[model samples]
Target: MLDSGLKTQLKAYLDMLTQPITLVASLDDSEKSQELRSMLADIAELSDKVSFDDAGSDARTPSFDIVRNGTDVRVTFAGIPGGHEFNSLVLALLQVGGHPSKTAQDVIAQIQDLDGEFLFETYFSLSCQNCPDVVQALNLMSVINPRIKHVAIDGAVFPQEVEARQVMAVPTVFLNGQPFAQGRMSLEQILAMVDTNASARAAEKLKDKAAFDVLVVGGGPAGAAASVYAARKGINTGVVAERFGGQVLDTMAIENFISVPYTEGPKLAAALEQHAKEYDVDIINVQKAEKLIPATTPGGLIEVQLASGASLKAKTVILSTGARWRSMNVPGETEYRNKGVAYCPHCDGPLFKGKRVAVIGGGNSGVEAAIDLAGLVAHVTLIEFDNKLRADAVLQAKLRSMPNVTILTSALTTEVHGDGSKVNGLSYKDRTTDQIHRLELEGIFVQIGLVPNTEWLKDTIALSPRGEIEVNARGETSVPGVFAAGDATTVPYKQIVIAMGEGAKAALSAFDYLIRQVPVDATAAA
Candidate 1:
């Protein structure tokens, strides 16, 4: 049943519908179907612009046919669109109803300019916040271009297909049945992957290429900042990253970034790239740096090898590879990862709105996640293995202040319990009593720790025990002309703002190293 509050909101969104949108739900003997039919009818009553029609098709029982202005749009939903997935359904309808897709002008033009046909199989969970953004992006591309087809399948509703794909996460996009992109992505990023020969472009640059003054690795806030700062010095600059947004894409809400009081992960990440692109910096996305080779001399060219057989040569290298959310690695955690288990609260919390969810970890990240999700979800359960909460007192106070939050200290997460299709609950053992208990919740957000992206540099550079690259106050690594920033370094903090500051410092430091010491013409640039 739709809540009065939610219905009011939906009505306002539907009021601006440009074209008549029809939702046809085929009724079946099952109660779920009957309920879906009733719900569809109720939704249609919200506005005269929206209508409902009864259909007879039962191939995917209780499936709906979404038509715009009497013409069918290829969008289909195999299950009832509820919980966190509510936005996905609304956005899909809005797309079909003639609402312009929310994308940059250049991006839309690029999608329209695409040459060949491509099939997109996007696997998602109803309760993932990041899933909707990806789905909407793909859906928009398909809607704007006849050659592109985007099929969004709910991982929870189709476990067999998900298992066959060996999917351990949500928001995994398979381009023509091959895993294309995983995790959260922006429209600009999806365009880069699907638009053209991104690898070829990188290769072209690597050939007979003028050595870069500074090369920023990792495309997160730190890397973007470094690229911009380096380019500002009026020298050749380049950035090669696997993903532009990095872990920022995996994040949901960002409340602390200094000047900006509030923003989402993808939004902030987009801004990072947008600002960096304003500079004369070469950005190579969708590529990983496999190895880092230092120069033969103080001012010689440093070589960066790529996974695509492409190599980048730069005077200096700034490492901002960032880090990934730590997984619990327990049973069912992987198989039902995207189905019900998630890592980023900001990215997937909305999918469980008004539903019970749990946050694992007692540290700042977990506590912050619980605080954030409590506002959207119905209830919050904080699970920590230690007896005492490890978060700051202020955070602990804030969490304790919330009426919808319950803290469970001295508890060990044993297993993620879920049906083959989706997560239904979890089991934990009480550290004090040694008694195992099961929790019934729709989602689990793991925030235990972060694993740095510095493994590739372990043998090459001076690293801390945790594998984070060791850096000085100036963001310089042990290797000369090499620097590190953000979550991949030994920076005291891992916040986005901190990373940006570190990146700027690293860029300035690199510039200082060049002008004061390194020669541009000697030793291949020495």
Candidate 2:
């Protein structure tokens, strides 16, 4: 039974906690359960203040909510908040309490004094095990400035929400309702995006416009190479991409990419972007092309429209949009992507060095990736829906000789199992025996195949039955002024070197078309 006086004091304390007051509580074995209940009651009381009627059964446990008082702040918690998160919670309370350390205090002072509100959401997979660092960092920021609020979501636990955001990797952070960063980012990088958002908002008020020439749609090796070459040729080249690195950014290491004996995908992509920018290539990050239409004049010009309603006109266009990896579309697959679920072994295999991994597919790509991963990872389990591997005989023989590779033919991956962030294991049904068994592994790589990003070009240009762009020997597409290269085109092989060579060929072809339109004297000099 509780006394009226104690209940009143508890309610007051809850109000204070909700408003920038900090409370730290520790418990011993005998009082642990009771202490937890008391703390939960306090949180529940605060929930009532914020109009959370369904504060639910676990009021003491960490949850999510949006509080708006002229300004809106989204608050969320990851994990139980009883261990490392407890201290983090305390700091968060202190910061939100309106008192913070010198560095945080300064930033908060600036933010709170601002007129508009900033909303942020961070997504993480529980299996990442490294995502807690990001949560703690954000908690510290929240303590310094209440204006900067965050929502932390478990990628695996929330399928619908994760899908809506199109979260392909863990530690993905969004600011002002837009994707700001992905993977593990430092505190400075996170803050920088916040600053950028603030500046962009301010610029929007000013209403300014910018233009460019030769806008490349993708930022893969092919696009990066094209941007570098085009910018050097003095064309106002600009590369707009949803991500800076394209598909190769997720790769682990490249032993086969010429000139670079060994390199990670992020490192390689960074270098490519840097080199292109040095030549004055305007690289626009986090932008997607909504449509590509022919120019009204019909002089081989293209009008590229962005999802943001911004448009650019280019005398010539290069289509180097690469392919996306095929997924299994199984229940747990989405939740575990990049956690225990992967699409490219060459991109993530080194991270699982000496650990067990599963390769799903039996085609050439699957066999090749499995063979490559076997050299680094401790064990490789190859699961194929078909009864046999479709790889070349020599490659199959090599895979067979490798002691770490195990082939499971006529099998299907039914479900992926993990806590939430990473894959701990998976279950598969053997077609031969009609028995399902779970295999323990640290990762699962999906190497089914690649699908071209040419779906949008079906009506705009000619496409092969496989959805790849139809290009001539000189890399000219069926359209007069448009050129296609890389994996998106009808290239026999999909290799980085091959893509680079094709991009160069396409650029030369575009230059030839340009020369034909100019006067003979000017054309001869060019």
Candidate 3:
């Protein structure tokens, strides 16, 4: 099932097993089951501590469980965990084999302290870049606490389950047979949702932290860069983010980052976090900033209030909150999200296979989604509000060449139509004729653009008309000792490399501002 090169790599990883483990598979006379058997056989042959067993009794065929020897710890995979989920499978094996996780010690303790039983089922697609995080997180929790059982199911392999559950998006999680969440979620985010007192505990911990010399908001490319730069100066640097990767976690292909020929968003985000950790930066995750309180006096500390009711004080604050997907804001759009509406094509495209769908934009992301969907879905209708497509000429040409794609320019999406359970169609208006048309579609992929995550900063700092934080050439905001950078700022061409550069510049500017601040006593003496 695995190639020679893959076998070699798997063997190297299998050597990390510190304890004996068994692969218990439930199989039937099917091609997928045979393939899974071969893969399990290959895996068992690679390590002395690993063994395979076919005496499994799971009702779900072509599924397997990674069980630690003589322990209740077990994690299940409901399909051939290839592609993006391959890493998830590897991590499960290692964790169950007594290999330590890189998760923070506090988080591990929280998982261990959880009291209730949690049966989690995550529906995922193989091509989804976002599914691995959700899968690996739950698997880790399951390994840590025997009461928390999790099974990562491949939606492609279990089409009937996907349809019955109305799961049209990747990484759709169900806890105790009820819908829990429907997007990319971090381990901390999931724990916060389940553990009722997690926020209060986190808030108390954060309130006791010492003030930082440089504090960065957000955890995308820009915030990561700023944290690293500030910490390298031997100052007390800290980063507070709702989620460390931010919008970068939702992204897929990233080809334009210079020096690096090609990489994915999640991978780069991990690298950024690792790089920052190499310094003295204090990283805080899954904590949203709710308000910005400027310093009361010159050279005073700036306070950032978090949604968790905790406040952090810093001498200098760098706002790099980044951006999120721009929703259509049309009727039923929000109501049907993850039911028939999704933002990521690479992640959720497979769930709509052989069904008619529509791409709601004409930009690069829209056209690219349409092009990609044309291969999976029965038909793709690309709707654009402008008279002409704004996508690059190359992408437009490629989209036009697809026989299953239909381009509709000068069209505005009016509303999404659903049957309460799922989406069935949508209505759009023709700009020239003022006529509205409805298309029968099983899914709608929104790819318009991004909006800065600076809504909380309004009236606190200068912001552009589009809600982006306004910054000068030095990356300093209108308020002294508060700088801004990245997609949330007024920087043009919001690219990752540009964000990193801007973040670095903002850190330097903040340092300069700190040193130049004359002491109150010194000014009085003068």
Candidate 4:
């Protein structure tokens, strides 16, 4: 199934290998084994620096051992790496060829501090684009800390293991045979879970009554930036978030975050957390804000109620609750989510490699998703409800340039049809013809719009009809001493760079408010 064009690409990537590498496969006499061996031989033929061989027969399931430069770096795959996993295999080969792991030093330090015999059993499917991220991060961790050993298992190749673990998704990391993380995670997040002593720091019961100069709600890009700014002013800063990394954790490819030309979601999230933690900001992760009450008196503490049943008081508050992807409320859409219907094209598109898929909607997001998927999947069919596409002319032109992509305008999706276990096809109607059409597909990606996370602030702060928090140029909300930023706000654009700027402004405004307040002791002296 390795196409000629893909072979050319792999040839180029493999040419970068600075050192000789060998792939030793322990295979049995089976069709699947033979296919895997053929694929490996094809890869080995591409570069003179690379070679592969079968090391006789082993009783256990097939395994691969990658050796480089006369040393066994101990890189291995538990099963045949196929589908999107082909890329993972290539990356592993490069790493073993002496490519330096680009993980941040701070993160590596934390990994080194971790003590224990931890086995990272990561289960993934061949097609999951997100799986490579988690696998790559874990493998780097294993390289850094000898205490940690990682094995990337192809879930499809190991049915018995999948059944025993009750595995239903890709990129599932089991720490010591217990599920630790279910989706794409950053190196920092994985380390946090592994370091029991470090996790204990956040396990302390939140005080029912607490105080701060500034309290930032939401732990996404905006909240991370805001806390750093607030803490830099030498003021008491605290951040309470439902989860750190916000919507970024769901993002797979990030090419538009400015100077950084490229980055994955989980890696960026880890970096954001690391950058924020460089200061004195007290970040409380994985905690939701139940309620918000603005102080009636000036300089009075703004009370924030957390889901943990603890209340916090702060001089000012910054809301950065992020938005979530809008889902198409059609039959089988919910049931087949992750089974084939997905939202993040960057994260899940690769899983559909060599399989046909459909993109729902015709807006910028939908078109962008189609364009991104066209490079990975076998073919892409974009279905739009409108008479004309809403994406920019440039994007439309680029999408049209792809040979494997087809666009259907004035098409309304009626429903999603799926097999008992996963998605199989899609149903839609042509507006002008009033004729329904069904296309067989392995996956469907919905990219309609976004829903802001402002429901909890109802009646307490001004909100747009779409429920986004209303804010001024200075990031001030309707409620005094309360500010908002990021996707949850009425910001004209929802981008990481814009969110970070807005967060900085909110922190500065909160500081302005704090300095202007008269201390109770000063009032008494007066």
Best by lDDT: 3
Off by over 4 Å in 4: 1-60, 63-77, 80-122, 126-129, 132-152, 159-168, 172-182, 185-204, 208-210, 329-359, 362-436, 439-445, 523-526
- Candidates in order, TM-scores: namely 0.67, 0.62, 0.83, 0.62
lDDT of 3 by residue, 362-432 (tens): 98889989999999999999999999999999999999999999999999999999875578999999999
Model 2 per-residue lDDT tens digits across residues 259-306: 778886667887988888799887766556777787554454587776
Query: How well is each residue in 360-475 modelled by candidate 1, as lDDT tens digits?
Result: 99999999999999999999999999999999999999999999999999999999987655789999999999999999999999999889988788689999998889999999
CA lDDT, every model vs. true structure: 0.82, 0.68, 0.91, 0.82
Give the lDDT ranking, best first: 3, 1, 4, 2
Query: Which candidate leads the pack in TM-score?
Result: 3
Judged by lDDT against the true structure, how good is candidate 2? 0.68
Count of steric clashes across candidates, in order:
6, 11, 0, 1
Model 1 residue 220 CA deviation in Å: 1.4
Query: What does candidate 4's lDDT look like per residue over 296-380, in tens digits?
Result: 8767889988665667889899999989879887776754666788787866776788999999888889999999999999999
